[model samples]
Target: MPSQPDSSQLNNGSSAHRTLSGGGEMGALMRTIDWAKTPVGPVEKWPHSLKTAVRILLDCRLPMYIAWGKEFTQFYNDAYRSIVGNKHPAAMGISAQETWPEIWSTIGPMWVEVWQGQSFGFDNFKLTIERFGYPEDCYFDFSYSPVPDDTGNVAGVLVTFTETTEKVLLQQRLQASADQLTRIFEHAPVGIALLSGPELVYEFVNEPYLELVDHRPVIGKPLRVALPELAGQGIYESLAQAYETGQPYIGRPQMLLKRGQPPTLQHCAFEVVYQPLPDQQGQTESIVVIGFEVTELVKAQREAELANRAKDEFLAMLGHELRNPLAPILTALNLMQLRGTSEVERERTIIERQVRHLVALVDDLLDVSRLARGKLTLKKQRIELAEIIAEAVEQCSPLLEQRHHQLELQVPNTGLTVEADPRRLTQVIANLLNNAAKYTEPGGKVTILGERLDDEVLLWVRDNGSGIEPELLPKIFDLFYQEQQSMERSQGGLGLGLAIVKNLVGLHGGRVTAASAGKGRGSEFSVWLPFALATQAEETLEVIPNLSQPGQLRILIVDDNMDGAEMLATSLSLYGHTIQVAHDGLEGLKAAQSFLPDVAILDIGLPTINGYELARRIRQLPELQKIRLLAVSGYGQQEDRERSLEAGFDLHLVKPVDFVDLNTALFEEQP
Candidate 1:
């Protein structure tokens, strides 16, 4: 039978071991085991070294155990019992194989080595254990050193250990998270960079950041040294400021210098953010850069600006060319209507009407340009709605008669009054009316009706024309939108009439809506205009009586177009006035000094000396000090009118003006 061999080197007999049978729970359980039947048998007669090792194991706060003699019997302290959990008191004096059967197969060889006087050590040693009902993964750091007998041969093993599963698991999860964050940083689409230390040394930069910096190597070097080209740029200073202040900086469409190949420009744009990264103690330790390239967006905006300016110049030249011919035709018509025979007057009427129509189209195109640029202004005033309705009807009646459409009008005797731009209101109503007539078949019935409801006046133009498609009703007022898909339509238009009407109404704080059941069914376009507070209604004259009268006032006409100037002089001469004409500004100034004309009609854009300078020169002469100056131009912008006033003109007139309006302008009253 095996009695416990001496482990004298590990433990000498002490008063502590002599009392071990009832020292603690493990000790109490050990005494209950029948030790004499085991390999390390007979507890009362056990060797002094064995008793000493057991005593020392039971006193430790750290998990420790002693396996004595050839049986490798288990003797463990209270802390070791907790490590084994519910396998506790029953495991106290059990053989190592019996108490730790789950891991005994793996640790048995190591146990044999320790008994043979060899030591075993493990750090974070893994073992699958079934101490509880289910198996669990456990880790430990432990040492199994040989305990020698009094005969000088190894007789037992002493073990000291710690469970390290929780710490190891936590470290694994932290590493996984770090790897995932690193992957995300590498693939991010925007440029990201990190700079550490007060000297602004570059620490990490993603691929996009490298590309933004012209793919120059920058890691582990200060920004100024790495990108020597950035020495004078403000970007380095911005980064430094963010670090020193601990405040973030954001730049939108900020200019940056990226030196390109020799011929290309050095300017680039970016939207960038710089933020400070703080340390655990709350001091800023680094600067992080986040940004995207905005060079394309900046370039696109500048290109658009250039194109718009070019369009404006083209429009100005186009307006001048169109008005030059129209002026001569209008002046010729005035002479024909006053002095020609019946046949001549009839033909002239047709020419005059068509020329005026072309002028209206040109004016509409110009208005569209102004509307798109947000340059149109409304001349708002208090006015009667009924008068505007009647005038707008008269304006559209020619198209209505030509198309052979029947118009039904509904109005109240007491006029609906509103404060608005009367001219724009008239244009709005007339555009709707003309639009109705243009789309309608000959003899289609159209109804134009207006009524007041609460604070609004609703004007409805319902036409039995080819109606709009239901899907297209909402877009009728959009600029350049047309109901017809065919580019060529019999009813000629630039698709601007309704768009202008919409813009004008909106400017007056109102809206326009179009309703149609479907294609081939009639459409209704309605405008809702707000009614202003009523004041005294003044009776407005709806017609202009021909006010031309024979007179002998001397006049001078200066224009670059010879036909326009001579025809206009001829028309003035028909009224018994002596008219002198000059084809250029220099000739006109000479004529003004010689003829001593009472009135001078000047066209802007004359060669040799433009009209503005001529006016100034004419003003300086004592012979023409009191002469009335009338400025005429195809440029009808507000600035054009202001410039005319500054040039000492008494009045300004747009081209293709009615002869009657010209008469009134020349006399400052009815001629």
Candidate 2:
């Protein structure tokens, strides 16, 4: 430390300095001070050097504060007033410790150095200063230089500073936001890329985007340079268009070719969109590309289409081949009814029942074909639902008995009516019952319940059987979807029954749904149909007797199939009728004219001519004008029936013709 200075250097001689008053803000503050109460005492009695330093501080336009004497009293110009907002005049006369006590620990050392004649200068120095009764972090570019007295000894420290708190804080906030954005770019699930310049140079690529390009190096390179394989692909052109015209482009499942390890082009399908980014002048500057890879999904869809087509072709062929022999087998059954003994008749009944089931399976396949082509037509009418239920129960009775299912029927006897096709409605309920009976174990309970709601009729078929798998339940009604059959030597079905049920219900503006708790827990299927109210006029219905009247007739049968023709002829002959058979259309036509037959039954497929052409030829024969013509065919589509009617046939019978229906047509003549 230096030796103590002379009294003249500390306080200068009393009354030796002039008053420091001026036109500036600090000058105005000095003019209003009560110098007698301050440590510096009255202005006239202050030291000359202290007075000189105060005058220089007040005259300067820069922000300067003075801590004088031992207390380091706080003093500043108007510019520093805004920095220490709201702490103005009260802070003016206080010591540096009292005015900024919270920050004194940081700045107090600097002041001690200045007072010792050692100067200090700091930039961007941080401190927590208590200015508004609370501590706030702030920064400053300041100096703590010694202020010398007249004898060249330090008397005070001079402070010159500029608060850069706001500027520094703004920069920090901007940097934090940038860091946050970088995190989002790196972790986004979908592919994202940012490109800049006319050539669409890659400025950034995220993790997902890197995977899309096989992790190729693309940053800072033009898109074409990065992926030369995409040159002729539409993607490059689309990108250029959006970049140049500033018009966005979106591509869905567009293929992009990239080279792989084997140098072969690997195609990736992506739903990508190119969005233009504009600069301040509203001109295109960059582009943002966002996309989702859909390659697997697209491939799966294409494969599914091919599979469905294969299934459809298989169904058509299966249905056709199955129907061919059904006609002969059915004819044989009818023949056995009259010739066979009681024991043979019982076996004949079994064969007849099985043949009918096989025909139903074939019919269902044909129905599915019609459904796929959207060519099915419904024959809707108003009828009592109870009548349909009775018919369905009768149809499913054999299967129910075979399975030994305890059947329970819950239905209203009358007044429960619906507008529906009688045949289709009966088929729907019958199918549900059949499926239930087939799937149920012996002694399992099967229930058919019906309830009428406000405007809909709900029919449910429930079974306590080997329940469906949970995963299979959702797709139970889909075409050709069958659950795993148990190991009981049972070929339950071809999986078309429920699909037909769904389609039939849909045609009637209704819906069908299946529910199951899981395997071995049971399943229930519900069909909801719009119901109708029965009027008094509809309450009374006509009763038609099912019995056939006995008649003897001269019949001519034509068919290409020998077994079908011979069996049918024998069955009709047992009805006290004279019958002749011809294997060809021409032979049958000649026989019909010669015999002058009462009825002519013709098969469509003949050797030299079709049944249609034969029917036209037979109609032209004036001698055969009185003969009733019945056309037989395997196809029962509406178009087949119409063609038969147009060919001069009075009635069209489907192949494997029901004997009862055929007898009724023969004996009960058209009105």
Candidate 3:
């Protein structure tokens, strides 16, 4: 039996102190503490098991501790000091119950099991502890093993632990982020899909992506197998490239053939992006696909293109058909001048003026068509505004006089110069003046006013006539738009004049606007153009030298219109030139070779062989190789002129051709 030490001996710190030389700060703390006042009494009276446990705990680098004796007196190493935080120094010699009172309910049962000779371990065990002056949730991986006394009975619990709070919380945050991303992808409006492996298996697809493919069961299926219609459409190739190169691939809007629910083939357009998702090794592991459907937009664009093409074709045909009949009427008028008596001179003059007016209307239709297609080009130059106004007035004089309208012109003679295409600008003013003349009642007053307004020139045409309604003002400039007219269309003009005016003005870098005081009042149109600095160069008129009459030469005239051919032949015959007429291309070719004519005037649209083929055939004849070729046609579009010139015509002339121009073509130098 061991005798109890005296109170003096118990209080003697040097007698109880062990030689704990290797431990750091905690070791020093242990040696300094007066264990005589503690539940475990002095250290010297400790059992061998507890003393050995203390030695093991102090020497360890891992966080370790010991609870010895029935009161559970706490002992710990330097590595465990940080876990105790601000309570470390005082907790060094205290009981475990006081050291971790906040977590005693959780850990107390485990300690009791260890006391009963049991060993236990836990991974990520949770506890609430007050380590930093506040109760905080923490996690730990730890084990509790029993230590035996000299009597071979369990007496204490030795604990080895590691704080796992940071690691466990980090894992939880990562899982939460993944869940949020999944929710975002699921609800996205545009198609989103994820594919994995070289097989490009559908790993995930959002609602939109599923709807895009008609809600097919495609998850876990390869992309090629799931959407077989995309087999040869370059979609699979693009995906492969993105995956292999580890670079993102952007797909432009393109037509795609899709298999619909009824197993019908349908056209769809899609714009997509394939982004490669790389692994830890920086190698492409999966691809994320995002796409938008644009089928309706693409379809509308194609339909619009087709409609424009149809419109152009229709206008070209209309121009050709309208001019064919007018050609002969003008030719007959010229024939009358060459051969008729003076008795019907007044009637001929009236017929000729009306024919010319009809020609002007046809020209307006063609001009508007060209402008709408962006094919009309301006020959811009510096010109006086008065000169343009004078030419426009002269063109509109016939209409103005026939309607018995009063005209008032007020424009400054100088200081109103602008850079503009003279011919187009003349057309613009003429169109406005014509509109004013035609729309106003007979003898109504029309006014032309011009002035310089700051940096711009202002010109306006005002009319006291049947003014436009307020609602119709905004739409008057739209092509072919007209207000409610009589069923007979008594106005007798296509609604193209104002549209041409607007387009031509726009081409000149100017703008035109219209105003009216409602129906039955009056209307005014204003044009604004940027003022240009006048140049010092004097305007010169082109002098067309009088052409000397060619000596009598055999001329062949080929036209499908018998009246046109005969009238043109008679007109040339009056000029002392020998003429032969042919009604078709084959007859014309024969006449060129047989007559060996000095010139051949060929009309296109001939029967049997067209004029172009006739020209080639005539050129092939060795005897007629020197004969000059002239093309006459009502189809006078730019492309028609180019085609005629390409087919070897020395000159291409539009119908209602003047005899003076014909004579010039006959003797002018050929290029």
Candidate 4:
């Protein structure tokens, strides 16, 4: 005899308890009992099955509701109340659709499926339900299965659901992260990919990654599918070892072949990082690989290295070739002048001029090298600016004649002395004058002026020749940059003269500037050099005293080449010296003993005994030791001169030497 169940529990209805457990456990087990046959509901107060189901529902997190067709919507537990809030009456007595109109769309669809005896599932579903008098967006993972009656007909839909808002948001975050990673991988310039197992299957690839290996499809395929040649080249083995040990492998400067009609080799730098992918089980499954293509850079670097080496060798050979022939040429010209014959004298002048031109060219090339290294050293002294100008004018006189130009000079009576390197100063003025003569029209005038300023000396060279174009004037001092007109003709030089002048003048603590109104007008180059105050201006000397005597001196000449030795001896004898010739160093030593000459001019490059050894042995003898030792050879670099001096020679002369200069060096005054 059970009393009626409490009015509060009844009013709350079974839906209240049913909602709490999310329709699982005891609620499901109790559903196995037939409620109609059992002593349940108000008549029995409360049955064991109903109590058990209610308790189980109270503990559930899922929200469940029981709706009697056209009756109230009853929520049994906390889960259902959380969903509906304070919307309905406190018990099962209201229509569900009338209470929550906004959520009817989802409910209507679910009701249709369950009533038709079908079980349906929806994932990542959304529902807009009225909670607390406010409509809110909700995400749910809900499923409904029809509950059948004794006749096997569907009676009600059993719904199971859970709030999925957090999971859905988490999924969105994961997707965003994946998208960002994909962007970085896709746009990367280097090749990037994933590799798995011994097959090295690719799981992902970017644009540059695929294009690197001939643009073959790599995703979902083994690395060998596109790079079968790599196995033969041993790249596959390297990659496998790196993966097995979880170590990274890097290959630098490897040559790879391109995929094309005509394949070309490409140099690439590669890095394979074995990053193991983890599954739900937490295990490494894949590796990532990255690579860089460096073919262009490597090729360019090698080409540049080869070019530099070739240029150095060329310069070394050129220096040797030019210096070698100078000694004999100078000696021959000097002897020719001694003959005092009109024909010989005229020929000697021509040879001398050509020699001077060749010397200037060699000097310029060497200066270029010095300038590049920032090693063009200047030895400055108190020098007469006007005299320097005169020397430069003399050097460029031939060029002026060739241009048929008229030259004029203007010098101040005083304050024309500058603290500068005499040789470099003359070179600067000469180069400017030569350039003017070259560009000026025939019959044009080139005027050189020297003036004294308070702190500096001003030397300006002005030419009424072809003037520089406006655009070219600014860059006139740039190395190897000749004007357009100059390059179009054979008369154009290497364009190093102005550059050398600028550098040399700068080294002397001076400045040089060029200016011209425009083309075909004329040009002016002005130089300002530091000045040294002078008590008196030095007058120009008329003549330098000759040192060599008219009387004869016995001399021995030695050379490997017979023609060269004979030609040299013939020239020396004509200069009032008795000469004996030998074809080799050994023969020359023998000749020295027999001839006993006042002076012995030796060639460094001779057969058998070398120049240094020959000179040493000769100096060992008392009679030969007393005689003057002159080294006349083509090797005339600073090092060569030092070595010759060490070898006991009184003077070391470079080949193709200037006979007049050498004569002045050897004989300060004629005997």
| Candidate whose TM-score is highest | 1
How displaced is residue 107 in candidate 4, in Å?
8.7
lDDT of each: 0.81, 0.81, 0.85, 0.69
- TM-score of every candidate: 0.77, 0.59, 0.74, 0.54
Error in Å for residue 363 of model 3:
3.9
Error of 4 at 326 (Å): 5.6
**Predicted candidate 2 versus true structure: per-residue lDDT over 368-481, tens digit per residue:** 887876768887778878899999999988888877789998988876778898889999999999888777788899998889888999999999987888888889989988
The TM-score ranking, best first, is 1, 3, 2, 4
Model 3, 12-76: lDDT tens digits are: 64435453445888777776666767777767777777777787788899999888877887888
lDDT of 1 by residue, 1-671 (tens): 12343445113434333637444777655544556667775655677777777777867778998887777788887778767777776666667787788988888899888877889889999988875688888889999999887677788889998989898888778988967876776799999888899888988899988878777779999877887666666888888889989999998797777756553447788899999999998889998889889899999988998898778767766877898889888988887877766777768878988898898888887888778788789878777688888999999888899888989988774657777887889999999898889888899999988888899988899998889887788788888788765566778777888899989999999999999887778889888989877657654544545455645799999988888888888887777888888878889989999999999999999989989899989999987789999998888866787888899998889887678788777867321
Q: Name the 10 consecutive residues with the lowest summed lDDT in model 3.
A: 1-10
For candidate 4, lDDT tens digit of each residue in 1-671? 12323446544556533432345443433333333232223313443433443455456676755442222223244566555556633333235566667777758777876778778788978887767767777788877766554455654455667778789889888999989988999888888888886678988888877777777776788877767756566677777776666666667676665554345544454443445454465544677788767777777777887776576446545765776666456656666676676766767788888877787777787677666656566666676787788788888888898778888889864567787777878999999999888888788999988887788888889998778898898899999888775335855578899999999988888899999999889999999888887657554544766455645677777776555566677765656778788877888788888888777778887789988888998998777767777887755445567899999888887556566565554443221
How many residue pairs clash in each candidate at the backbone level?
1, 0, 0, 17
